[model samples]
Target: MKRKSNIKVIRIPIPTPTLLPHTTTNSYLIGNEEESILVDAGYDTEDTRKLLEWEINKHGLARPKRIVLTHAHQDHAPGVRMLIHWMPTILCHEKEEEQVLSAISPWEEITLIEDEDSIKVDGEEIIVMHTPGHTLGHVSLYIPSEQILIVGDNIVAEGTTWIGAPDGDMKDYLQTLQRLRNLKIEKIGPGHGKWVHQPHEHIDFVIQRRLHREQQLLTLLEKHQQITSKELTEIIYQDRIHPSVFPVAQKTIEAHLDKLLKEDLIQYDESKSSYVSPHF
Candidate 1:
């Protein structure tokens, strides 16, 4: 792919069930020529492809090379089969190989890209970094020349990202943010939410927010020594929080509990959703 010298980003909005409008996932069409690579595919529905096709035709794209995912979120990983049905490969974070292999993904074929991985598209090289926390295999894509970081769910531009249990980690997520701070990023192309104008500053803010949430989790567990995940989630999510986002938050708290349990900070008895803190 050759640089057209008139390249720009074309965004396709996918709004699912959420507090945010038109922002479940954003499929970014980035190119320096008529051929472009898609960042993330929308939900697993015909509408996603139709919307993308409309955008592709509208932009006069001559070719679709590859489709990329920030992580294997249901909303973000869909339509890869549709994409690979036409394109060469659907690139994913190498950490996501299991997600892809598990057929948990709606796609058939996917190539993994890990941290320190790079790909050439439209005369530009995109670097991949394993920014896990949202998911063990979640990745952040970076364009060195552009100073842009196409982060998946590690850090949403606006609200905080979920560090749900089973995979998400508060410690890793904070470290990922710190890792990004070391990079000279100018624009943050997030998987969801608005574009981040102040790159590193926004990342710092996100890190602070995650740490605060971790503290809140610690306090919540200390206050309620014995509570079911459902009950804890409800208590954690106040009236102001959207119900749609609670499930994810619940998973995040569960993830923290699992971690704390491993560190002997907390003990859990699955028969009861209660968690006991050693420090308490």
Candidate 2:
């Protein structure tokens, strides 16, 4: 689909065996007649490969010269294996090299990118923004001409993006959200769901929701004295989340705990195998 600017963006929802509620990952074909860039290939499957090829052929988009991955998640980057025939130059943040390589083949050459790197597609500049949080190397592409931002997994159309431990960080995620809110964005093409029109408002909602959850965790920590992340998740989410999502919720709770611990607001009790307020 053509946006307000000269660039064309076609959102192809590729089916993937991802987490609950997210049945497909949105891979975008963005560019003009001169060149095209495919953002985020879905999981490695014949179905995914066929769908992507169909979309490209239907749109008559030129063979994408490059494949820019937002992160190295299974649902996002593994499909690069299917596109090896295109010999497209793979691009991703330096921090994501290890994971990206693991997802694809180790022998595949990857070009590392940093913040502010500009990719010219048919004369239009697409600025890369390293919006780490959901993952250490997550990036969002910005089109200054169209005031559009294509966020990989930073912001979704429905609910909230998971900020779990290890790969995900609550502190970094909050900072990323604040940074995105300051951008001159009119539309957002997220990794999942439909396009977001109220960019700032959507960003603000995510920010506020995270902050509220953080505050709730603090309050619970104070009330419970020493509580495990799993226990905290049970209290915070209760029966709202499915049994299958319990582990994900617990990981997110652990991320919040890690943030609070770093801030010296909470302390982990080794003996109790739980977290507690610093004063406790």
Local accuracy by lDDT, each model: 0.72, 0.88
Best candidate, TM-score? 2
Please give the range of 10 consecutive residues that has the lowest summed lDDT in model 1.
15-24
Per-prediction TM-score to the true structure, in the order listed: 0.85, 0.96
The C-alpha stretches of model 1 lying farther than 4 A from their native spots are 1-6, 17-23, 101-107, 269-271
List residue ranges in candidate 2 displaced over 4 A.
1-4
TM-score of 1: 0.85
lDDT of 2: 0.88
lDDT of 2 by residue, 142-215 (tens): 98888889999998888888888679999999999999999988899998888999999999999999889899
Per-residue lDDT over 76-134 for candidate 1, one digit per residue giving the tens place of the 0 to 100 score = 87556556567456777777777754533444567767779877766677788888877
